[model samples]
Target chain A: MKRLRTFIALAAVPLVLAGCGDLSNSSMSTNSGSSKSGSTQLTGQSTDSDYEGVIQSGHYQVSKSRGVTNTQDSGNTYNLKSFENGMLNVSKKVFSTKKYVFQEGQYLSSTTVQNWLDRKSKSNTTGLNPTDNGSKSASKRNPIYIQALEEQDYMTQKNNKLSLGGVTIGIAVNSVDYYKKTQYGATYETKITQAAGEAYAKKAANTVLKRLRQKSALKNVPIVIAVYRQASNDSLVGGNFLAYSTNKAGSTSVSKWTPLNVKNYTFPLSSGQSSPNSNDASSFSNFKSQVENFFPNLSGVTAQAQYDGKSLAGMHVNITTQFYSQTEIISFTQYLQTTAQKYLPSGVPIDITVSSTDGIQSFLSRTKNEKKFTSHVFNSY
Target chain B: MKRLRTFIALAAVPLVLAGCGDLSNSSMSTNSGSSKSGSTQLTGQSTDSDYEGVIQSGHYQVSKSRGVTNTQDSGNTYNLKSFENGMLNVSKKVFSTKKYVFQEGQYLSSTTVQNWLDRKSKSNTTGLNPTDNGSKSASKRNPIYIQALEEQDYMTQKNNKLSLGGVTIGIAVNSVDYYKKTQYGATYETKITQAAGEAYAKKAANTVLKRLRQKSALKNVPIVIAVYRQASNDSLVGGNFLAYSTNKAGSTSVSKWTPLNVKNYTFPLSSGQSSPNSNDASSFSNFKSQVENFFPNLSGVTAQAQYDGKSLAGMHVNITTQFYSQTEIISFTQYLQTTAQKYLPSGVPIDITVSSTDGIQSFLSRTKNEKKFTSHVFNSY
Candidate 1:
């Protein structure tokens, strides 16, 4: 129940550095400041594309260039400093995709996890006969990939009871790697044929299902197995995947398995759109780059998007950075919104949660239209 | 942003009656009774098709005929008495959909709102030209239809900025009616050609857009207008709707309007598998019926389901009753989940919230494969 209450944060990162800054804003004021009289009514005439139109009476002026400015008589102020800083450094990091395999492994060293598995195998050989024992545990080394994939709770719950009903299990067909080493850790080696990968993923998934069925609650849960064909060093998030489900005589026990149509399990923000089995890794990388470009000092960042079939439903982008002032956070949030509006197909709400290197966390949420913002600074750090 | 923090409850029903119940359970026990010695090892051999399998060591026993039975050494118990009561009288006021014109009137009566509009027109007259001024204050009679349509905040926000950037606005091609009167109070006679309905919905929607654009904050918001054809007195929840968007040259003002594919804006529980413009309404209705069937005294019920394009993202069901015991609530929740799993697409999280006529609110939530449930009861009535 606690888990249900706590919606998953966008990303998880290790503690790397510590920075300090208070969220105080000294410029907040309620007085309606009088704009400079006789100012030119730039009204749609400005050549600068960043021209943020003219401010109406009793409202704050939007700065074309960027800095905090209180143009309204009320306390409302337009802070563009963060936006300007981000724009100035827009080209610093161009978005790019990286190849990696999407699979589950605790983010332990490959040697460590393999050892753990060996020990478990020696102690209890009742289940978990890993067919792809031939393949190395390479995915364990990439913490981001591990976190992204493992966090998905594949089954659906009915009547308050958790079941594997209708969940399509995914298996990796071929070994994929992002690089020799990820920012989090080094990669392990893995190589398997497409047929072997399918056999391995399905077998691995069934092993999991078997364990679940042992429990009284999950015995009757329905599930499916899907195999994905991954190119060597391909992005783990996106790819064409095949689904296999059991043919039941009367919704009883399995009566052999049949292959379903090629279903796509896309990673969020990927460009592949809706391929039969794969996601475009390049699109997500570009999205990440664009996000990092807006922060003043981006340390490390992990962004995740959610898709319903091929339709992108929502996204959670967590940015890790050095100390950011309150104004900087606001500005960064605005910048992120502008970018999403430009790139993301509309109506998708994006949750931008920022965690400082020191562990301080803040959440900025935006939904299209209906001008209102929900944000909170967590001080537990 | 503050609005984002407050997720909408399933319904906003007016008080129709009052009910009462106490949250007491005299059946709390922590003893694990040993099974009868030499009992048949039902362990997987009972071919009784209704076999629910064995009970887990620390879990409760499941009754195939539906009754609460505790079989765990731990304090877990199967509270099925409530379930049985619910199933006994499943025909108690089944949740159904009502239809009304999807016009904006602040959910007030048509005549009252129109009169209000007339006053504003006489005093301000800056905008708001009422083309169809012949109708009186009739819509106020239909509260259910009004609440059903007005509560949808479909578009996501960027930061705190609400825009229609990617929301495909759905418009009904034919003016639909629920009956002679609606919950909010309306009885308007409408008979228009399909072309006329299209023209009216569009002009009305555009008028709304024009009014919104008058505000500086909403000037740059992007929106698409979708229209759907509905038979007179049809359910407003599901059906294929059409879409129309302007071809803006530079995200400024509308350049020219273009008709888009008939996009669907389905109400909960309708059917039209994943499509650009349809939803599965029947499934949701059945889910609702199954839920109501479990509750002893069900009053008014309002349920809503959300979809990302065609993929179901989540659902919110609010029920009003006289009173309920904790066990009864649990039974109802379990029934709801079971129905959802059987009917809904896998992995779509469902949020079931309940409100009692006595002014008590409870929320129970579950995600796939996650055994624990999140529930809290609040007495804010």
Candidate 2:
């Protein structure tokens, strides 16, 4: 059957989910080794484009974990998306998508996460954030550092049941701590230096690893911990991972920390501004120029480029046009694809979206190492 | 070109948009009466499935109008959608989709709408809801009756210029007015009866008509106006249109009003409760029973049925399953289509969405009067 073949493909495919529960009344269960591995059904669904959800290798059961979003504020949607995707990318580097099954973090409840994010006090010793000091002035008070925490678990089949194989935790630290003196007062901020934020993330990670170890099912598995420095309060884009560490099996703390020098930059920077990589900036500029010449009536052409250190990792180009004719749009998309292949950095993933005043027009994307882009044009009106 | 045919097809397609502006600095413009009407391009993109967007027939130019979302609160997303779609459905009855192109309401700016939504005062005479009585008690105070307003413009090509042909305005009135006594105090509400809300809406429509007549370009064209009763704050389903009217061409007032008795009820109505039409209710119950029999492992199978007066108009069935095997999913979808065709009302549009624990797996839908169902099985992992 067509459906069966699709399942077989995923079983061999390496993907993300990189979980543990007691045998009693737990969502995790075993098949008593009666069914062979080949009978395992691998089903997939991706809520976010930045990550791929693994198909479980057995009967379907709803996940029991309900993930939490801590300290959510206005205009934080972009941050939430990027933070989750960034963690998935980190997991991909350490855990193969083929071997691990994904599950939301079950060991931590929203209530527990809320308490841990709060300032330590007499009643709440579980708080990982710094304790509040007795100070009337905002400047004199200790800033609340940690923003939110995310947990992801990966499971592997062992003894005929899925068990915890690996865990990925993302710790989001605010660059600008948002606080209010009174409930109705204007929000105040405490600017945190990147060095201080990273240090706090490291401290928080240690506490998390120890806390997770308390669960018998999570004790001996490798834990991949990542630190994220959130964007400024008014940032249009989300934050990126600052550093990551993978403690070895049975370890209670991060074995080593690897710094990631990843940064996002907008193309055609404002006057007197330039990017770290001049070559990339020039390529994007030239691409924009050629596209502009094709459709002289375009509204705008812009791009968000992600650079890993000095090398371009991926680029998302947004082309806003005023053309509603599908012929003009298709011609434009085809031409743009050719232009992208010629101008963009080779071997880097490139995604270009064309949208009109109406809605999205077309999408042309090429994954890493791909020679040609895959294009899709929704049936135009 | 593969894209060329798509455009030609759409130029013949009939859809929603049912706008005028001063020639100077307006998005509307003329082509010196040279280009033939068939030379026009019609390309569409639907932001919502309940309404289809219209493709314009000319050189594409971005719309000048900036739409607004007023008094938006948590859990009002469903209300906004149903209100917009309900307005479109009303438009389809009076305006020919083939002759009109769609545009967002351009006459009423967000600032103007905001002023109109506020309680009438010296600083704001344009308010249409009511004047605040300054009552200290929450129950005695005048509720903020109006929640939001939406404008839709339809254009007809005239003398090589796309000009306003018709207009539809939707006024969303609150069933429960949410307000706080103090800035940081608890939210309070005053329940509004359907008769009271409907009367307020009619009064609002007259004001909107007079306001639009003040604009020289809008003084003469016919306008379709509809009033919507917003659902309760915690309601999962959106609100419905209460009534609608169309003033004759060149008329400044509504010719007559028509009442719409439409209500949405869940299938297998709560114990001891019955629907206006027992025949339709029983049909839905039989359909749900057949689906449950097919998959005993289902999480739930529920349907929302819409009745226009005493007749069944449409139904949306949601089936939550735990089957992840692509083969099993395909089999389930095929069986569902067969079951739906056998038991559902013969002449009503039906939509059944089957989603597993992962995400959406398959969709089976049949338009009103269509004999066979069209099904799509998303490629599962």
Candidate 3:
């Protein structure tokens, strides 16, 4: 009986040890499997994260086609004239097809292009890309490329002469922001707080996007616009209020009021219309109108369309005009005033401000009489 | 007799032919020599022609010197002991042995580095150098240097590290035309005209010399400035005039007058001031005062000075000012109208023009009352 009991205990001990070993092995295998799966999952998560910004920003799709041909010579040798001519032909065709695409974005906006040209002209001030205005030769003259077509044609000409024998066309569409200014006067800080009145943000966004769509080369291209609001004040008296100037007779006084100087401006949205839908109908029509009006020579179908909301808000706008002669602009201003009066309601006070571009503010006082409703003059040296 | 005649004829023919050949050779040699000599003379004349403008425009001279090094590095080798101490011996010595020569001529005014900073700050513009305003970190984030700076400093400071390594610095000093609008309605063409204006010829000479000097960096280490001036109208109707409005009580009429549109304003000459010396006294003194007042930080001695006839006559002054905020400038102007009445004389029209960095022009109309001044505002998108 003692021998049998000892044998049973030994057998139970072995069985218990075996069972523990099996459990350990199974747990280890499960942990290893989990680790592998976790690693793959991590990788996928990271890839998604990386793609998030791009997807949010917007996506641009491109496609290319090659032309090929074969020819037989008299010596029974085959020549591939089709590849040569076909490549050129295809490239030209592609360029022509996408020409309108390149013409529909910011480049088409009169204001945008004008701004660019003006900046280029002021390269002298920035000391970047200095031009020789003294050069007498035509070749030395800095030709201002005003038209998108001109720039494209020049690029094509250069590419055709180089190793890249065919034209390479590209279309890029982006969303942009629109901004506007509203004023509240008290202390500087107070004014900033109450500066952006209600509806300023929405109006800014609408105005900017609408204008951009009306004038840009990327109008038809898929775009996304974004809107943002920022609060700031022209005054240093920081508080939850804005500044305002009260006019009693000819005198002005500043006072603070509630409301933060928050302005909402709209910018282009990042995600564009990826797949064609009826939602793009208005945008497409608007883009078509812009192209037809501005780029009469361009030819192509709208390849893509999208909308993203974005904006640059709480920015100050400064406009400076340097008059070599004052009369022209004054006359022009008077004409503008006359025109504005014709359109604007008479009761609306045409309040205007004047300042000197030079630090000397005394000019404003000396020539107060010269200031007119239609024309506000600031001295720009 | 026939032989004698033939001999005589042959001798005569030879003599006649020799005479003709000698005359031709003499004339040809004279012509060839004259041609070569003429070309040499022309070359010599060209040099003088180039210098004519520089000499005739006006005379000015200046001298400059770079400050000596204040700290000298000790040529001591570092050991582990010294390295651990974290102390390096640098000898403090003042040395003025090296003196730089500044030729007698007008020197281009050295632009204050601070001015660049001021402009950048006022306009919310950045990237004057590679290291400016978090350019390095921004550069790491973006492809273009300027964009990087703007994004990092102006947009968001999410991840920014100030790094000055691999940065480039550029410094430039230039003499530019000083243009001021005159009471006349005419505009002055302030650009360097081909052969017109006082410094046109000098400008041409300087341009050529500048090109020549570029062969060696040391050759043009210090730039010389030639100041030029032309008459321009201060009124908006003038060539250099910028029209701006201040205050108009009611409807106004504009008069068309030739002198009012005069291209130049002539200042009366004081006693003993004549051609080439007219601007010697008052004008020079005024310039000196302006410079001294504006550039108090500059440490240097004036080497020489010369001037044209007429104090402030036939001179152009380019004025540029930067303000911390556009509203601040406007406020300052209002203050001037209210408090600084003495500085601003009545009847003399003042025009203010505003422009963006991109050079978009917006003219401000003059108003009679300060209250209306608040209304003329435009925002930049």
Candidate 4:
């Protein structure tokens, strides 16, 4: 009967874990690592019991207890918490829950981060030392994981050990939600004004810090909360809200947050749109590969991400091909748009130019919209 | 070994029958109806022996005897002939073979005509009177089959009794062949002057008549040899020479050929293209279905075939839908072109107009060419 109960819990794990898009079974396999003495460790015990208000802020709720992280051992006990802040009225809202572990690298692949988290969890649960697991070194476990959430809680888990020395919290306040009434259906408005939304974000960050101080195991971890904000709904990731972190001394130093930027982040486009330094080539390589797979006739693809120096403005793609048929050109362009939307920062303009055989050229431009939106096409043969 | 040989032949029958595209075993099952007391009957013997040169004209060869029409029955000895007229210089040439049978209906569906042939062959082989079989009537057996030949000698078989009372031949001269040389590849020049090609078509028609007269069975059958000439390579079917029949007097009267266009069959297009009274709504219904299948969102379709007083000229299609994407417009238009090309006359222009939502209009016009040709697109949005 207990074995059957374990099977049922395992079957329901995926559904519970799906709330956060990252905690996939294949990626979150707990790493068997050697343990070291003198470090405080905690293990999560999945429970069928629901716990509310574990992590709650303003209009957000992140700590919904789901039995996905449960183990076969019934004697184990685990504490979980989730916090959110966003919409007050509406059927939909965006809540981001961040689990900061001291790790290396500004940006780490999800698999790597999940490996670290797995190692950390395995070490605590099995009483095994991570150093004993020769597959990965301890130095690789000290990195930051930043996730952007919208419409749904798309948080996923990656495992790595927190540095015994300390923990750094990277805080990013994403897009703000607004209400709009339409005949078709009610929809959420994107970032309206940062000044109006920043107050909520700052208070949420402070609440997170206060909650962390209450935890005995995390009371001394150095906190680095870097807040990010979107200028408008259509803008991609917003500019940084001046980098601020807790002093090396202890959690007591997390009292004050300061702006890290020399000036307010803003880069204006010729079209009068503004954003941050969004031209991250490495970030868009995967998207380019997807485009190439869709259109094999493309001899070459050159893509540049647009930024206002504070947020992502849009993306521009120039392609060279031998195809001269207008239908083929249009089909290829639309396919590129469809694929880009899946991997790019939402609400940014996607501009593409196709140069084909016989000096034929075509341009397709589209952007996310509000008061006035226009999609334009230009062709020369 | 005998069973194996029979199995092998049956296995290969489908492969051999696929060249003409319409002679599927399932659809061509002969229906037997009551047989009348007296008619000059000749049975076909599906023999392993191949007899060549039954029909020959100019450099084109349609008389390449295939043993598929041979019979195993010794009493059955059906004589077949096919005369072709085209070119010998180019790698690709259009050759047309017309088999005039003493029957009813100037126009008959290919499948119906094939069923009659299959019935005639089966009756001759099994010695079963068609009337005794109670499947089809004698009236169904008396229809003339006209087949257009192109790249290859795409001709099958048919049989009927020659009316001893008298013979009438329907002559329709199809599109003429033109030639042009370009860097990409050599393309045919369209009809430039009918006078130059009509002489050749007339000679070819005389050759066919001469061949028919030489046959003992067909000697009494009145022959109508059509001579068609195209204005341009893109023209569907060409101008008709005329209808001529054997004199009621005898075979001696078959010498003179006359023009059948007493009123000059003229159906002028809005764009000034002249054609015959060609409103084949039923023939293009299947093609319309294909179009609808290609574009599910299509609201309506309008298609018309343009026929020269004698043969087909081209086709025009107008479509209405609520398409907002340019890719959809191109895909639908391309599908239309591909489907139309399979049924419409070669080299003829296909003009399509698509009316989409938001008052957007797309026009695609294309014509087959030799070396280098251009397709044009005009959009009003």
TM-score list, all predictions: 0.26, 0.49, 0.20, 0.23
lDDT of 4 at B158: 35
> Candidate 1: deviation at residue B81, Å?
53
Q: What is the lDDT of residue B189 in candidate 2?
A: 81
Candidate 3's residue-wise lDDT over B1-381, tens digit each? 000101111211111111112222121122221112211110000111011000000111111111100001011111111111111000000101011111211121123222222224444443231222432231131111110000000010111211111100111111122222446544322233322332232333233234324434224232212121211223211112101111111212212111111122212233553434433334434333322222113211111111212222222122223322222223222222221122211222233333333232222232333321122223222
Give the Cα lDDT of each candidate.
0.32, 0.65, 0.20, 0.32
Q: Tell me the tens digit of each residue's lDDT in model 2 across B1-381.
A: 001111222323222221111222322223323122543433332222222232333332222323344344354555654676677678867776545655557677778887888889988999876888987466798998888777777777555455788888888898988888889988888889889998888888888888888888787788899988988877656677889998766676665788877776777788997878998888788777656644336447777777888888788787887652333455466556655776788798787877765555667678786876655554300
> Which ranges in model 2 have alpha carbons more than 4 Å from their true place?
A1-41, A45-67, A70-73, A134-138, A292-298, A322-332, A356-358, B1-381
Model 1 docking category: incorrect
Who wins the TM-score comparison? 2
Instruction: Give per-residue CA lDDT, model 3, range A1-381, as digits (tens).
Output: 000101111211111111112222121122221112211110000111011000000111101111100111111111111112112222333343222111111133233333322314443332111243654333443322111110111011111111111121111110111112224522211111112332232232233334434533423322222112211222111111111111111111112112223222211112562322233344334323322221112222222111112211121211123221222123222222322222212321222222224221111111123222323322221
Error of 3 at B64 (Å): 55
Query: Which residue segments of model 3 deviate by more than 4 Å?
Result: A1-228, A231-332, A345-372, A376-381, B1-263, B266-319, B338-340, B352-381
Across A11-48, the per-residue lDDT of candidate 4 in tens digits comes to: 11121211323333332223222121222111111111
Question: What is every candidate's C-alpha DockQ against the true complex, given to 2 decimals?
Answer: 0.01, 0.03, 0.01, 0.01
Rank by DockQ, descending?
2, 4, 3, 1
